[model samples]
Target: MSRYEEAKLNYEKMGVDVEGALTLCAATPISIHCWQGDDVRGFDQKDGRAGDGIQTTGDYPGRAGSFEELKADFLKAASLIPGKKRINLHASYAVFPEGEWADRDKTAYRYFIPWVEFAREHGFGIDFNPTCFSHPMVKNGLTLSSPDEAVRRFWIDHCIACRQVAQRMGEALGDKVLNNIWVPDGMKDVPADRMGPRLRLKAALDEIFAENCPNVIDSVESKVFGIGLESYTVGSGEFFMAYASQHPGVYHLLDNGHYHPTELVSDKIPTLLCYFDVLPLHVTRPVRWDSDHVVLFDDELREMMTEIVRCGGLQKVLIGLDFFDASINRVAAWVVGTRNAQKALLWALLQPHEALKALQDSADFTEKMVRMEEAKTLPFGDIWREYCRREGVSADESWFEDVKAYEREVLSRRGT
Candidate 1:
């Protein structure tokens, strides 16, 4: 038997449905940020809030619809793509201050409460991502790294408010809300001045989870690079892991595109999974060092997916399409991104472990890498065409037409 067949048999012996496995692996929610307005401007100004102006005048591209519009668009998009539930709220932009530090904090809570209530009424889970840039306190950054006490206090208050709202939302949704936190408090020029703020944030997180809700997972997401003076603080996965270890309720959130292109996630992923025991994953395609790419799969992605399956780590994964393409239609972008994700999952499921083993066990890792790269590049549409041909079934454009037709039907039913 081929390696795929062997793995299939092994999987079958475990009483796992290979086909069902693909669907389940593909199951992930479409998370949307609320502040993305109608225009394709990168700055979110839906709430009519202040300090929302952009410093640079470059034309920013991506979906820039309001909260309700984005939600409706996502519903239409999700209906077309099967097996996805829940949408992430853009809590970051929602909390941006209009002016004055005190007023902004109060205004933030006012804006946040309604979103929590909306998520509850809609039967969707809310994933809260804290935005530290809204307040002038963090024009540089926030958390323990802030040079000013006023800025640090402002961040703490905002975090506290976020946790409170998250707790209430979780309670309303039967603890379905995911309280996610990704700090932009790292330094670029300086080596380290934010250690104190980081420590404070950790303590605050511990208190939040200890108080109201144990159901919500506090996912600490990390980026690969920092932008300014406070840029280098938490720029890598290792920093996140270390920081998370200091707190009781915190867990690491891994974004695929945040690492170096050549980094072997197969080994790295298992270590993180085992370390945390229970963790949430963020999925996306990163080009060079820049993330938010809405493109299809690449070679490194195949290695990441294969290892996740080999380690039996699908259940812990929370798939996210972190792409932002303003040029494309908002609704269509979601559709295409979700479809790409679905295709990636299918490809991962069909991957043969024995093929990987043969390549790895070979003398030179270079040949193995080349073969793995080829496997990753396999197109789902082409695979479907080949399957039809092999089965002696006539192939036509009608198949694709039917798929699009079904999508439109779902969207119509949703009144999108």
Candidate 2:
């Protein structure tokens, strides 16, 4: 038998439904980072210029040139993925020097306009990260945790401006633009004297939500670290549940990599779903040291998928492959990482509900493990190939190649 056939046999041994797997696969929205390459700038440790001594407040990478060029580059990178056009704008563009946070009005408007136009012209949506680490306001972190009143004001104003811009852009494009807000506003030290800033930040968010910007959905991102501040108020899951619940339009956005090392991945999704409400997901693998590494699939990932299926909220889950500058080509990095994520989702869907029901109803941990072990494993690429072969969809060697070809065709017609 052929290698494809052999792989199929292995998948079948897992006892998963092939058709159900593909259906979940196709429903899954393949997303990537908007700032697709070395263009991402912020947090001097990662991609910023060396020896600046300044930790934050670096220049924006994508804004090095004209706005038109940046817009075109974004389109070029996005065109590579088939049936997957949604993107998450890097926080750097909205906060770095020459970015939206730098200007109160014009620059912010100019910065988001191109993306809005791009979305309108291409029929795609854009996700925004409310400035996390660039501006002086965030030097110590933002929202419910900033010590300085002036710095807290700065952060709050930036968020207000983003809501306004998102509203305008939505009117311009006729679609919702997601406002993703994650704060490095947690404390590593003692938790005293943190309540004042926390209350202030909460009040600020309440004011922003009262504005009722129809174009924006505030998705609050949670993290475990406090940057310059001695401590943070909103780091853990319980904190997010309490804080986000008070707000009208905001929802908790769970980053897969942000959980504690000892935390159970399966328990997280269902627990969050049961309590704080399910929002969009920021998908990425976390290392033992809590570094955000974009790597391949592992056996542990199955737990996350199992929980996702168990919750029966697949539609609420939005896929984001949150990778940093570890790869040579950003597009290739996203496609490969996303492919693995999709495979995991597909495998989870193939699992019979009966198996999950058993686990959910069981009191014994060993019984649950046995049920989990009985679920089948599906080779993602092989399944894709099989589906394509059955449906007569031609297989491309690489997603990047497909992207380049499309770019050439589009630019050629534009006479670039």
Best by lDDT: 2
Segments in model 2 whose C-alpha atoms lie over 4 Å from true places? 1-17, 42-83, 90-110, 139-144, 186-192, 226-236, 355-371, 377-381, 387-416
lDDT of each: 0.54, 0.58
lDDT by residue (tens digit), candidate 1, 84-104: 456665444453335623342
Displacement of residue 277 (Cα, Å) in model 2 is: 5.1
| Per-residue lDDT of model 2, residues 129-176, tens digit only | 655454434543454356677666666776777777777766777767
TM-scores of the candidates in the order shown: 0.70, 0.75
Clashes of 2: 6
Q: How many residue pairs clash in each candidate?
A: 20, 6
What are the per-model C-alpha RMSD values against the true structure? 7.1, 5.9
**lDDT of model 2 at position 406:** 46
- What does candidate 2 score on TM? 0.75
